[model samples]
Target: MKNNRYLLLVLLMAVIFFSGCERILDTEGISRITSFPTFQMQGEEIVTVVKGGTFTDPGVTTVEGYPVTSSITGSAYIVPGKTQPTDVVYTSGAVDTNVPGIYIITYSSTNPDGFSGTTTRTVFVLDQQPDPAVDLSGSYASGTSPGATITKVADGVFYSSNAWGGGSTVVIPAYLICTDGVNVNVPQQESTVRIFGHGTVAANGTLNLLMSRPTFGPPPLIDLVKDWVKAN
Candidate 1:
């Protein structure tokens, strides 16, 4: 039991440590910061741009918002219109996009004044089925890892990208939510599901869904659950 507890703790710590990274971009006036999306699909890297951080650098005289306690007497701003602002980077665990569908990302941080803020983002893995038919098995059920590309059956113009596995099964947990920006809610038909392929997944195998039909937000999820089933 002790060993198990330690192992669980280690796993928890590992999870926290691997959760990506963040930083503050200080442009003279300390303007804005944007975080980009990173993922692997069909042996290719896919990145989407994101806008975040409406932070104003309190001032050169202040730390974030509060006044700097001590003067560095050093640490000049990087460039004229910009300087490197102090920030915490969360460069740890990369998100798993091996399975297709929607993913939710939520983050919360507290300011020195005890104020806390939270945010989220959505990642939608493409399904080769451009003209997605109403199939119960799943969507995007096929693909090769290293990653691969397929024309969406549901949408003729769009292309679906995916990662591969050795035709193993995948299962995700009962995730309550993903990102908060978009609004949506669709009840899950079941508690969990098994996914086939790394990137493309169809609705055939058992799967997970939200409680309400989400017209917007999070893209829906089941990858972690699918992977969980495989490892166990």
Candidate 2:
């Protein structure tokens, strides 16, 4: 009977002392904690990380924030909580920060009581490529149907009437200004400019045409005058 009572006291004391035993209380191997690592974020590509057998405590992850959907490169990371973090520190990796110009990265951590400390990593973001350039300042000319081709006429030869429905105007070097692939421009209101050879020649023979209002000039001229009449 006395031994039973004595055993009860010892067992009671044992319950109190063993209740605080750390190894018995610790279910996970703390030594197995993973160290947080850094990553390079690209513009907006998929980014990922692997844990070296460490379990993710549901409400805990890396300090970069939430588990990022691998499709969008963002400021996401597997942040270790107040507990020590573990995972091989990464180098030579890339991810997309998704910003237009440039960006940076740093490291930090959270505590068990919801507080945080920090370590750091860095990342760089770059710009996308630009479109190609084109040049179209040269010369081109279209005739009648707006699709008509004006043949280069020889000296003393006559050019036929085009969709303009009148006799052709001999294009002289002086009267010619510019010709886009579609339309043509000439010196403003030149009545009879000579079709000197392709270069600057003097006194080349010319073709004549009836000029209309705004003072009759040659045909094939783009008349830019707009005379607006207001009623009194």
lDDT (Cα, tens digit) per residue for candidate 2, span 111-200: 443454433322222122211221112222322222212233321111222212123343322222112121122211222431111111
Quote the positional error of residue 125 for candidate 2 in Å. Answer: 18
How many clashes (backbone atoms < 3 Å, residues ≥3 apart in a chain or on different chains) does model 1 have? 67
lDDT of 1 by residue, 143-226 (tens): 122222333222211222322222333222221111221221121212233112121222332223112212212553232222
Least well predicted 10-residue stretch by lDDT in candidate 1: 70-79
Off by over 4 Å in 2: 1-3, 15-32, 41-232
TM-score for predicted model 2 compared with the true structure? 0.17
User: The CA-based lDDT of model 2 is what?
Assistant: 0.27
* Per-candidate count of clashing residue pairs (backbone under 3 Å): 67, 24
